[model samples]
Each structure stands twice: as C-alpha cells, then as structure tokens.
Target: MHSSPRSRRIDEHTIRSLPKAEVHVHLEGTFSLLDILTLAKDNGVRLPGPAATLFDITTHDAFTAPAVTSGGGAGAGAAGLSGFLRFLDWQCGLVRTPAQAARVAYAFAARQSASGVRYSDVIVNPTHWNAWHGRELALMDALASGFDEAEQDGLCAVSIAYSLLRSQSAADAEAVVTDLITRRPHRVVALSVDGDEKVTGRTGEKFRAAFARAAQGGLHRTVHAGESSGPEGVWDAVELLQAERIDHGVRAVEDPALLDRLVGGGISLGVCPRSNVTLGISPSWHEHPLRRLHEAGVLVTLNTDDPAPLGTTLEADWAVAAEQFGFDHADLVGFAARSIDASFADPDTKASLHTELASVAASAVDATTTA
Candidate 1:
C-alpha cells in the first residue's frame, strides 16, 4: 500500500505527449464508468446503488476490494484479480450485440489516443462477452470493424490477441486458436492466454499443441504467466507454450535460471506496475521488480494491463516508472521502443511507429528546452 510521491520532474502533460504502445491492455477491461452506465441501462441490467458507490475505478488500491454487487446489496470492492475478473465478465456481458461491441472497441481506441498511445494490441476473451455466444467470428469482425474505424479516423492503430481464459478447457483453448487461424480475422496479430494464473497452475503443457498450431499458421504467441503463479509458470510458458512475450513476468526475478533464460531468449516481459500493486503481487511501486528485471537484461516493457478497470493509463504507468524507478524521459522512450520491438505488429508498421515515436520525443524535448 506504500508509494513514493509523484515526481516534480515529470508532469501529466509531458507524460501524455509521450508516444507509446500498449501491448497488454484487455478489450473487455476498457469500459469507462460512463460506458458501463450506458451499457447497463441500455441492456436493462441493474447496477448496485449510485455509480460512484459501486467502486472507485480511479486508484489501484480500490481495485482490491471484495466482490462487486450488481443490484440489491452493497457493491463490494474488488477482492483481487479473481474478483476483478468476475467484474470484467459482468461488464462485458452488458454488450449484447455486434454494434455494442464495436462501440466498446471504438471507445477504447479514443481513450488510448487521448493518452498518447499510438498503437495497441488489445486482448479479448471471447467467452466473457455473452453477446458473442454462438457468434465468435461475428464478434471478431465487429471488433475489427471498430478498430478499423478508429484507425481510419487517425486515432490509435489496433490489433487483436484472442486470449484463452485459463478457466476454460484445453479443448476449448485449442478450438479458439484453431478458429483464430482459420478465420484470420482482420488485425488479429497473435494468440494469448489470460485470467488468474493461480487457478490454472501453470498448465503450459496443456496448450502446446494449440500454440504449435498457431506457430505453424504464422500467428505470434504470448502467454500470461508469473503474475499469480511462481516462476515455474514462466518457465512452462517459455518451454512449452513458446511464448515470445510474457504478460506480468515480474516473479521471474526470484529464479536466477529463469531470469537468465528470459534474458538469453530475448523474451519481453510486459510489466504492469499498477496492476501488480492492485492485485497484491507487489506491496508497492517501489518494491516492484521491473527495474531489477530491466537491469538484469530482460527486455522489459511498460504497459497498462487494464486501463479503465485498474484506473490506470499507460501515461500513469510511465510516470510511476519515472517517479519510483528513477527512469528519465529517455528511459521512458526506450521502454516504448522496446514495446514496438516486442510487439506482434508487422515490420512496416513497427518501422513507422519507431519513426513517429522518435519525432515525438524530439519535439517534446525541444519544447522543454524552449520553456
């Protein structure tokens, strides 16, 4: 629960102006408070009491509250990531149509643009969206359409990573990957695994066949590991699932051999600082192993795991990295560069974003100099 005061060396404006890419954001977790309210009312879903009282989606600590009540009883705070996952299920459930899903995607794009995110690899667990019940492909198309619409408007460019929920069956996981490869939905970049890792207990061996299929089909691989489970989960992800990038691999700091493997293999760890604190994985930002991982030669990248639900933006994460980890502006820029390198984006797109990020950083520096 402890944290250092915000650094005076960085300001919100500067942080927002830093061009960045968000590789770990969840599409279902992108719902804003206003969007939540609108979706619930439109679908005749009742929420607990006043919107503000349900939960404060403004701070990381608040996300640790108990189960959120939907209608009658008092809304509980999010107990942990497990509780948050249930809340995510309910929030995404409110969108019962393709158009609504599109709206959610577009809204997420708009929010990311406002925070200076130039690119995003948004993850979605299709099972969580009840609206997509028997129409997963349709849901994917709608989401792609929304992202395309946003890209057309010159907002953030978007991609999708069809995530397999850990709670689901191995057969279900293979089916999702099979469908993703078969459909080849627009802007689909990779296959991913998400959900509370503790419940799943490092079942990487179970998904190897599916991941192998994805690799054969040219889709990239990334897996959620080492967040809730131990370093062994990360090891399984690398050895069995062949994850090119791991979401929240902070626990790798505990195992020297695992850390060496990550370093040698050039696997990127998409570290979400606020998420770790909110989920009780790390006691505070200062205690986070991000800097340690970076210093140890791990390809570390900063990201907002779930912006709206966690009440954190990429800009906020960068600021915290600066304030707590003593990263300078250049260091923040490097984090963005590494994200681009680690992304499943096409080479041409990656080159374009690299150029754009450099220009933006130069401009920001020039403006600071003049001031």
Candidate 2:
C-alpha cells in the first residue's frame, strides 16, 4: 500500500522548518582551519605547519601545537571532543585582539544563520585566544561585539557561555564568571563547564567550586558530562555538580535509573549523533540513543557541537536525526520546544521565540501539503 510522494515532501519540509534550539556549540569548535588561516593572516600570526594546516579538521599529527588538540591516547578519546578541543588550541592562537575576536564571532554567527538555527548557546573558551594577547577583556568584548553585529544583520540570536579550560585554576574559572557577572554581556548568557572532564578523576575540587560559584552568582549552568566516560560521569554531573543539561549523555541507556532520572528531571541532553558515529561512540548513526531517549521522554535537542571541523551543520544534524531517529513533524517540533523549556533566556524572549517556532513550523506544514 504505497501512500504517496506527497508524504515524503511534507516530511522534508517539516524538517527544514522545524523551529530549532542549539544548546551546545563550542566557539573554538566552530573555528574551521580555513577560518583560522584568515584570522592568522589578518593578525600576522605564524601557523607552525603547512598552509594546508588551514583545513585539517580531524585528529591532527600536530596535537601539541597552537591550533587544535588531537591524536590523544585511546584513553583520552580522540576524534570526539579531544580532536575538537585540539582545533580550539589552534584557533585561539590567532585571535589576538578585540577585532580578531569579533571577526571569528561574526563568522561563526553567520554560519549559524545559514544553518537556520534560531537560538544558540555558544561555548567560548576564554584562555584559548586570550592567552595569545595576554588580555581577557578582549575576548569578552569580541563576543559582545560579534553578537551586536549578528543581530544587526538579522542573523539568528546567539549567546555565549564563557568556558573554562579543564586545566584552568578555580581562580581563573572564577575570574571568568566574575567578568560575566560584572560586565554582563547580554549575549553572554551562561557559564558552561567545558574542557576535558577526565581531569577531575586525576585531580581536585576546583571543578566543583567553579560550578558552585557560577550557580551562586545566578549564572545558568551547563556541563560537558558523560561525553567520553560512562553513565557514572552523567550521574556525577547530575548528583555532584547539578548540571542543567548533559552535553553527551549517550550512555544514559546503560543505567535505566539514570535514564529515568534525566527524563523525570526534564534535563535536556544535547545529543550530537554524527559526532558520536565519527568518534566511534556508536557504530553508525542508526545506533544513536537520541531516538530512544526522545521516545523515553528525555528532553533532546540536536546540535552540531562544531560545524566546520566536523564538516557538519545544524540542519544536517536535524536531517540525520530525522532519518536515523525516525523523527516526524510532531517529534522534531516537540524537540524544538524542549530546547525552549531548557533555555537560559528570560520568559518574554523565550515566549517570543516559542511563538516564532510554532508559527514557522505550522506554515511549513501548510506549504508542504499545498505543494
């Protein structure tokens, strides 16, 4: 019993028009090596390797260098966040000024705009580029300036969560939170706990304190939990530090109780499927638990994590999720709404965005049916 091609057309239209919320994007992860070279040339920084280094987005042989980190031991889990972080090490080297920061920020925003992302919480690693210039304020200002420019261009709205490198002192992480509270970039909305979580098993209480201070200051909290490790890390993020969202909670399936806890708590899991597949989390996209979680009532939001390096876009992620996760119009729209519920924005803004998403999603359905 073949229904019709019209059903397929409607499905594709609905995916494109589904209102979207991108809750986890690393500003450094957004740094494409090609984009890095442009910034380097503008700032006159020397990339130690070949000009070809401009496009190396994967586990690089040049792990310890300036641009990005990669090729870690199997213990560190390269090709996932490690490879992504390595790219940050590279991008931050070239961003030495307020102008440079703004350029990078704007470039990332433009890419987001092209992806049809309506709201984004972009993670910014302060020390990455700031170290090159020896100025923290420049990184902050560049982010602020970038948002200003993007809004004027009618691009999608964007926000920043100043990410503390895992290696940074509690004092340094606190300093960044202090800046967020004091300077208060409207676009810089939250304080994200990023960097390698593996540091905690080896080290001390700085991670705990940094998140506590951020919470005490009324900063919205998100953490990169259970990305590489097991569901225990997810539990640690939920029980120990009180994270609002888990960046990659793929292993939640391993613990049914934890899985139920996430669903019951209404915590959004920023699931990156292709990234999981590329990094070997699951053997293939079809194996991703995003579908399982969504059906199980966990708030699931789709994101690219980083686009250029992964050569992925948010729209592409949605498509894959739709195809792989068996998402229908209602499912994706519900997923979009989940992002709104978990957002750090004020009620009015969140309300407005919600309205916009619904209207757009409705119109998309109408158009699809008509065509």
Candidate 3:
C-alpha cells in the first residue's frame, strides 16, 4: 500500500530521531557552498565564478551537465565524481592553517549532531588538502583537536580514517601507515584507500604491504571498490587488502560468487544510493544494487558519500531506503544496528548506541501501531 503523506512525515521524523552511526563519509566533502565561499574570502582564493551566481552553476544536474574536469569553468567542474573530486581539491586548498581545519572539523561535528548521527568514521584524504601537503601529521592533529572539542561539547563522536590515494607509490603508502603507527593521532581509527579506480586500475597489489602493516599496527581496514571498476576490484579489496569493510561495493551484485564471498566473510558495504545515481554508476534509484545486496544478506548500511557537493544528508538517505527501496521501520532499525556493529567504535560505545536504538525502535513500533 502506498503510504499516506502523514505516514511519510512520521517515517521521516522517526529516521531523524534515530541515534545513528555513519561509517562512510568524507570530511573534505562536508563543506557547504557557503562554507566554501567564506573560506575563499578568508584565504583570498578567487572562485571560478561570482558567489551569487556560483550556486546555480556549481550544483550538479545528472542528465544535462557534463562530467567536471580539472580547471574547468564553474558548472563544468561540479557534475560527475571526477569533477566533484576536483571541487574537493579546490575547496580543501582553502584551509591553509590548522585553525581553519579545526573550524571545519567542528562544523562537521555540529552538522552531524543536527542530523542525529551520534558517531561517524570520517575519511580524511591528505591529497585533497593541497596546503597541507608534506605536513599530513600536523593536519591530522589539527582535525583531531577540533573533533576533541566537538566531543567535549557533546556533539557527535568522530573517528578518523586516514586514506591513501590510489595513484600513490608503495613507499608513500608505507610512510602513511608508519606515520599513523608512530604518532597515533587521536581519533584516527582506520586505514582506507580511495581515488578514481577507473583512472588507476587494480592497485590492491601495490598497497598490500602498507595495508598489512596497518593491520599489524592494529588499524581497521576499509577499501573503496566496485564503484568505478567491476567485481574484480572488490575481490582484490577483500583478498589482497584484507579490508573489513568495502566502500561503494554495489557492483558486487553483478557477480554472485563475489556476493557469496562478501556474505561469507562478513564484510560490510557502505552503500550510498544517491551518490551512485549522481555519478552515473547506476542509472536510477530503482536500478541501484543496494536493495539486491541487502536482500542477499550482505551487511549493508546507507551513507551520504559526499553530502555537500551531492546535496544529501544521512537522514535523507535513510528515507530513500524507506520510500524508494521499500525498507520498513524494522529494516531501517536493523540497518542502523548493523551500522554500529560495522563501526570502529569501542565496544562500550557500540553497546550503548544499541541500547539507545532499542529505545527508539520500541517507540517507533508504538507510534506505528497507533497511526
């Protein structure tokens, strides 16, 4: 039965009220356009266009807009994943100082709190931050300091995942792991690798030693695969990199054997449906493989991959699962529970969040019965 407007509103309310955890989100992509405008002015970086008209040009339109190229004019650089990535590099370049980094981190935490995300594993790619090149450790410290303040102020608790670029050399990857092990920057919980897999194909063998070192040093592993490439990349992530979680593993649905492997190995997939649609990975929401993957019993959780540029929020993503994918209240609650389990949070935090989720789930059940 089609849900009434009132029922949809209730569902949205319930999703927003749920204490949630997000496992895949990029800190660099969290900045609002206004945030970018402010940062640009602060740093004296000229935008590709005027601020007032920039919004119309930079916003993404899946059908009409061409893929954004590096150094392209305003609208051209905000359309596809590659273009969105260039925008990330440009906006991140504006944060020249540690204080600016802190400001953005605190703002991210605050936004998460507003959206009912109690905890998030935020990915930080040093390659995006042009100003912080060769000073990644200092950048990490600045981000951690900001998150620490946010946590102390009772905002969402955040953990960092230091990501390696796909194009980086094996030595560069090893150095990142070594730095993480030696310094042990606060709130950094995992090691991840993300870049355009289409541009640099099959790099798992290249970063294997570095990921192994990360494992030996007690860091959790997550890899981006199956988005730009096919199931082969997902296989490398599991077999070669030993990733506990796969980001954008939607393409695994194409290979039943890979689906079996993911399910058997208990690997979690951080599937961002709208992002897939926006980037032309999947043709539309209904065609997206999130439903197929979830039905196959793979541990799947919804996320907003790059919220700001993509124009998404965690709550809105959950709503898509409900309204588009036909996940009911119980299923949504289950996904939320699985997200906490898949997180790199402490056991105590996971347990506590589960308890809180249980309370909200019960209330949701009651409200549904009444409605």
Candidate 4:
C-alpha cells in the first residue's frame, strides 16, 4: 500500500481533482472562524475575547490548550471534542435570523465546492442551535433557501440530514421525526442522531422507535457510534437503530464479529481521520482503525467531521489517507467512489459522480503512464 514520493504527489493531485461527496460533515461545526466572528458581530453577540484573538479558537494551538469540557462560559480557550461541541452551540447561537442561517449554509456549499466536493450530506442538529429550537422547521427552510441558492449558482449540491441529539428522550426523538415527516422540509434527505454518546451512554433502545418512524417516513438513517462508545454501540446502531451509515464508527475494528457484520451488511462508515486524532479517539493517524476497517472489506468513506473547527478539509483528509494510511492512487480513487456510494444522494446523482470520478481516475492513470 506504500506509495512512492512521486506517486504520492500525483495521488494528491488526483485527490484534489476528484469529484467527491462528504457524508458526515456537520453544519454547526463547519462555520469558519471569520464567519463566527462576523455572525457574532452582526447579531450583536459578544465574543469572549477581542475579534482579532478569536481567530485562534480554531487554530492547532487551540486544540491543545486547556480543555473546556462543557458548554457555557467563554469559548475562546475551549479544546477537545466536548469543548468543540460547546463551541458549536455558541457559534450556532449567533444565527438569530433566517438570513444568517442561509448565509452560513451558502458559505458551507461554497467551501465544499472549493474543495472539489460536488455533493454533500450536511448534518444539521437543532439541539445545538439554541436560537432555533422551537422554530426548527423555519431553520430548515432558511438552510434550504441558502443551499438552493448555492445550487442555482452552480456550487455544491447539498442535502440536509436533520439530527437528533442522543440525549433526547424517545418522545423527543419521535417528535423531531414527526416534524420532519409532517413538514417535509426542503432538501432534507435523512434522519441522524448525534451527541456525546459517552455522556448519554447506550441509547439505541431509546431512539429505536424514532428511527423506525424515520424509515417508514422515507428518510435515510445515520448514527453516531463507536467513537465515544464501543463496538456494542455500533451494534446498537446496526441492530437497534438500523443505521444505513455509521458516523465515526472506527471502533468497530475492535470486534471481529462486528467487522464481519459491517462487511456482510454493506453498511458504510463515514470515517474522519483528523477529527479522530484531534478528539483523542484513536490517538494518532498511525493507530487509527480506518486502515484496518478498509482492509477488512468494510465500506468506508473519508470525511471532515468538522472541517473548520478541526482545521482540516475533505481534500486534505484524502491526502492523509494516502500519505499516512498507505493508500495508493487507486485506493484513493476507491475512497472517492465509496464516498459517493455511501452518500444519501439519489441514484442518478451517485451515478453521475461515479462517472466523473472514473473519468478523472482514467486521466490520472494515463498521465502517470505517459510520464
């Protein structure tokens, strides 16, 4: 799986040029620091520090700073996944109006387009958005308006995956699903559940009915498991929640049986390497289970779980898979194809992305041979 230095450079170029889809990115965690600062000022929300110093909040240094494990207080010095979640709450709270929500959504699409991501399943959790709690449908409309505009302008096409926090009660989960089914908001394609699974403990039973409702109501289902929890959580996601895709399910490598299940069932894992490393989920890229899962025939798609806050991009993540994880050019291309396949996009869109990727991959091969 090792690539030569010259081949690595070519693979990087190929990765950058490939048409890709990100299946696990969160809208709340995708806000650029500049966007956060601008929204804060525009919405009359004060930052913990001066505007100039706020830029460091998403820098590499900030992740290693003292960990602020819970929400509340100033957000500038926060670190780790918990602190990142708190930052998402604070950042999301700044969108006091639908216009601001639309603006951020458009910015997300623009960012993805710049990274060569032609399509994306952007997760939007109403729980993190303190401002739009009661008016979640309105929030979805605002986000759809922005994404629709972005698509019309020839940016990336986006489908919203409305998320339920894992800490929510079954009733609460059902209520969210009910709203999704009843309102049928524009561009919402999936039902997702995310939060601190470690804090909430095992919640598969709690949300089972909700996920069933989502399935019956015609929404794709994705669950956050095996990052904070273990293989059992992934089992819950598969057996109980019946997840079509698992987000951060890197820990499934720990269980041979679970790996078999994943491989046999064809469930995709939206693996985010930098996010795992940044959050201390896998310690380092060298030790991350993504390679192991890939080797085991489990379908895996590379993603930037939280691009802006983690300070990485989708293309950079693909590069990491090649350089650090020992994936060759062909493997990188396979990853691109897997991303499109694992996405919630319609069959026609998936076919289009695959055809485009095949063309780029063929061009890369021709160039390499001629060189």
Judging by TM-score against the true structure, name the best candidate.
Answer: 4
* TM-score for candidate 2, residues paired by index: 0.86
Lowest lDDT sum, 10 consecutive residues, model 3, at 69-78
Screening candidate 2 with a backbone cut-off below 3 angstroms (N, C-alpha, C), the clashing residue pairs are: 66-89, 66-90, 67-89, 67-90, 68-86, 68-87, 68-90, 69-86
TM-score of 4: 0.92
Query: How many steric clashes between backbone atoms does each model show?
Result: 5, 8, 0, 0
C-alpha lDDT (0 to 100) for residue 195 of candidate 2: 54
Ranking by lDDT: 3, 4, 1, 2
What lDDT tens digits, residue by residue, belong to model 1 across residues 227-325?
Answer: 878899999899999899998899999999999999899999988888788777888988999888988999998888777766667787788778887
* Model 2: residues with Cα > 4 Å off, grouped in runs: 1-14, 46-53, 57-61, 64-84, 130-134, 198-205, 368-371
- Compute the lDDT of residue 261 as modeled in candidate 2: 95
Clash pairs of candidate 4?
Answer: none
| Predicted candidate 2 versus true structure: per-residue lDDT over 1-371, tens digit per residue | 11221122224344556656678777777766667778778877777567664445443565534343321111123543444456466667777667777877788878777766667788776656645445665577777798789879987678777666556677877777777777776676677665555544521256677677777877877777666677887887777667888887788877889988998887888887776776677778767777777667788777777666667677777766666555666667777787777767678868987998889878867987999
In candidate 3, the residue pairs with backbone N, CA or C atoms under 3 Å apart (3 or more residues apart, or in different chains) clash, namely none
Between candidates 1 and 4, the one scoring higher on lDDT is: 4
TM match of model 1 to true structure: 0.90
The residue ranges of model 3 lying beyond 4 angstroms of the native Cα positions read: 1-10, 53-79
Candidate 1 minimal-lDDT segment of 10 residues: 69-78
